[model samples]
Target: MPPPQPRTHKAKPPSPEPRPSSSILLISPENKILLLHRVKTSSSFASAHVFPGGNLSSQDGPIPAPSSPERHVDSPVYRLGAIRECFEESGILLARHRDGGGMLEVPDAERERARRAIHSGEEKFSEWVKKMGGVVDADALLPFTRWITPTSVPRRFTTQMYVYFWPLSGAGQDAKIPIGGDAMIPTPTSDGGLEHTAAVFQSCATWLEQARRNEIIMFPPQFYLMWLLGKFFEEGKGGAMELRVQREKVKEFLKGSGANGVPWADKVMSPVPLGMFEGRAVLNLDHPGPELKGSGRRGESGHVVQVRFSKEGPRDVEVRDAVEMKRLMGEAKGKL
Candidate 1:
């Protein structure tokens, strides 16, 4: 016996953490964005007006079709989930025929059928996509911001928000109907009467105003995004092409930062220290808003990021000083 084999220990790999989720900000051809109103009785973000999205599903896995932009970075999963959720909640499909036949051109009647089927769980989204011989148009989804739910929140979700522009049909010479901007409008729908009760396409500024008035609720990440979108539109960067360019700029800016590089996965998942915002760079973390102190959940700490929406467009994002932040908001509001 060869000296009875010496014992060796191997390190155990870390258990798989909960997977991340993705959301879509559907921007219409005329510059409006879509939002869904969560039912009042729900637990997480009850009665909050949020973007159209939900947790990823295994049904969103790979199929035998070609998708525009192929995959989102290294996986086709998130993009497919986003498309399915959007279709389920809003009755809008962001896909095209695999043969390059352009966006799915289904009649309003068929659209309702698909929406009802998926919403009821009677039909899996992937099966429907395959049956139609269409592909998820991931190219239309421009990467926007990354956000993580705060530690104070019991159930945390790591979410990536994408901007998808609803292209004009381009069939008619004069077909431009502006959906909305800066107002509190209700979209109570009975179609996807499951997770979501209604959908709205409010102007960014108006959405903030509604939250302030206690008409609807908003969590930290949602409010932050609306703040940026409010600036983008209020300063007239609302055009489709203009907004697209700005989205790319923001992506590059975040990528340039080592701590917040492309995918931004590392920084976005961890808790953002209070001291990290001293440099005024892109810190994609959640901090409770001072303005909403008495109203909104306090989040991890008593902190907020106030941005300056200049005539040139979102000039700066500031998170320090209570008085100064209020003053800046006043100035921005006046200008808007």
Candidate 2:
């Protein structure tokens, strides 16, 4: 008999931790949502139409106590980060005057200067707002949803999504504080083609249609959220909904739970991959990954979204039912 050899095992690589990040759906007074076209050279989410947001920074704020029920853990920081990133990426400051003058009103030249300074890290975001005699409208950002990147991905993030009703047409009667007029509405401008190429506002249906036709690229998250937002608008109505009325309807939806009694904000979505269909990745929003199964933390089921992956970026997003998704996946598997 040959000499016995000691057993050897290959160690598994450590899983990447999900970085805390925040994004905002900036809803215009006309009910359109702002979407930024990311630079093609960017490392992540390159060439995709995404919401304004970035990673949570240390200067955002201190984390909250985990046991606190009033607020989600690190939500204050997330909100601050979302506002800052929004300003940095789209030049739209979600801020109000400190003197209770509603939205902050400053000359366009001054706003651009401040934006440049903040983007260059020459000044801290919160300090600049305070110096300008304004306060960040953090509370304006309502908790919309949260997405956790799948474990299979090399780079991961825990992104907190929020919705901010930018009163471009003026704050509605339902608003507690009296916000200013059109002068206070900050215009959306790209960051000199640094990270974003353009900042555009279009109806959710328009964006969804573009994505469906492969005209623009939208990742699974943005695609799914836009689909949900489209429901609030009337089809073939020229996307005409008064600002006040739209704000009230959105507020009601955010306050109440979704299809079930469970609040949408409470849901921590981690879409589980079922299979593939026609070169597209099919993800199941109803079920979290195997690791998250029985965790009781992931919230209610939503929709099934698919995206065709490419070397440049993802494209051709579509929403389908579970049965149709399974059938497509089966056909794709058989083709292989």
Candidate 3:
């Protein structure tokens, strides 16, 4: 008898780590929801559909206390960050007084004080909450879904999803501050924040129906939320009742996850299609797969080319160059 030969195999590479991000699922009093179409820029997702959110800042932690509860306005420090992000991204604020008063009436000096403190890192969100004589009611935000970006991509995010209900009173008016940059304008009553180049309020059923029929182009997160909304629509009710139920469902879902769930899931490939032509290709950022094909044409001095996909599909993304198009298409192929 002879000793058996030892066996050896290749070691697998370590999986890539995920990044962190945050988003809000805001529902208005009329049962309408807010959505944003990302700007078409290298620094942005480029026409991708998304909820109102961004990477969480260090200022999102805690804040100082005001002299007294009665003197405080708005929400707590951390929550105020969420409120500010909502206002900046979609022009919606989740603040309300226990006495049923409006947040708009909050004094500019106090609001400005809190804003400056947070932005300057002079205050913690918790301290700010205490100063405002308010509580950081995490309950106000219902946890929804968690998503992570794929390791193959240069950019990634580990995101937490939160759902908030905006009453009928908060649905119609827009905040006066600018959305992204320093420019200011009258806030649009709907979701017309500066960051949101295009915003709309529609029922989950309408959004889902359009998406299912290929009338709307949406990223996975938006599509998934819409699908969830469709489930509520089937119950045959509309307005505040439906919104409340959805909010509760989201709350329950978050509570049930406990501590074992991942902070976010990897970004799923777009569900649409892709194409390659004339040294250039078109990729649909909303959907996955390579079966879909489209054309790209050089414009003006030919320094830039416009890549278009799906003649009637809801998603229409324009890639700047052949290199980018090829890289994106390669990613799509790898997913397949």
Candidate 4:
């Protein structure tokens, strides 16, 4: 028999394949975007603020055409899922007439009932849309980008981001307007205490400011999108211009994915900032920045670069390892 080898360290296990999910970026007429604060008890995003979205259900049907192009064949279901999840998570409904007439003006009572039923999973999304006599507002939404969770996570998601801008003109169409009518505006409310506990709307600049103070626990995708939005706003790119560019980019990605008839995902992947253990998913980044002492590009574990937010500056220093991670987790009763 061979001699026993000394056990020094254990390598992390590989994560499972990422599952597809969809989310919607609900842009208001005032350019203020909505964000939902996940419930602290939530299994996935726990206490982090995120956009209104969720996993796709079997009820999401085929891609509605004329609004969706043929090249985006694989994306319509995602779009449908996005719209459906947006309505369920946020009170705002994005559906409109198939003939591009106007959005359904759901009354306060009806809205409350629909929201409750949806949150409790007592009513199906397809049935609710049917009750309102409308299909998913596939035409109004523009596919924007994709975000994939880091490989360090045991479970992962490849989220599809879709953006829908509130109409600048009247609510109903006069027969000459483009795809659909103006979306009906509603105050967002969070009823799913299981997923989200609260909701708020803020400008991109304000959001970036909060990120600097570490008031919001944002992942790389959220952090990166906020950075991009701030830059775009600074460059004087109006809401319409930004959405147009995003729509064009989505088309490019879709068409490019069809080259070899194999579906390819256009995902913006970012490295994990904190040290992970045994392929565990990151729960939160509480007060993450270089402002803290010893917070830099390296730690006891590996490279620990901080994603810069506005306000505080960066510091250049030698790389260090995160030897205390295991110790800290141990002190905290195995909680990371």
Model 4 off-target regions past 4 Å? 1-14, 61-74, 172-184, 234-305, 308-336
lDDT ranking of the models = 2, 4, 1, 3
Instruction: Give lDDT: candidate 1, residue 85.
Output: 81
> Lowest lDDT 10-mer window, candidate 3?
295-304
Q: Give a tens-digit lDDT track for model 3, residues 41-146.
A: 5254655556777755656643323223211112233344555566455434345444544443334345545545654568664455445544444556755544
Whose TM-score is higher: candidate 3's or candidate 4's?
4
- Each candidate's TM vs. the true structure? 0.63, 0.85, 0.52, 0.63
Q: Candidate 2: list runs displaced more than 4 Å.
A: 1-7, 63-74, 171-184, 235-241, 258-261, 287-295, 323-336
User: What root-mean-square deviation over C-alphas does model 1 reach?
Assistant: 12.5
The residue-level lDDT of candidate 2 at 180 comes to 32
Which of the two candidates, 1 or 2, achieves a greater TM-score against the reference?
2
Q: Count backbone overlaps in model 3.
A: 28
Q: Please, what are the lDDT tens digits per residue for candidate 2 over residues 1-336?
A: 999999989898866766778999988756678999999998789888999998877778764332333233336889999999998898887888898777766566777788788877887899988988889999888887788788878888778899988765443222122223432245688999889999988889899999988889898888987787777854444333445566677778777775435677766677777767767778877654333456565544545778778886778778776666787678877887
Backbone clash count for every predicted candidate, in the order shown: 1, 0, 28, 7
lDDT of 1 at 311: 32
TM-score between candidate 4 and the true structure: 0.63
What TM value does model 3 have? Answer: 0.52
Ranking by TM-score: 2, 4, 1, 3
Worst 10 residues of 1 by lDDT: 179-188
The per-model lDDT (C-alpha) reads 0.56, 0.75, 0.47, 0.57
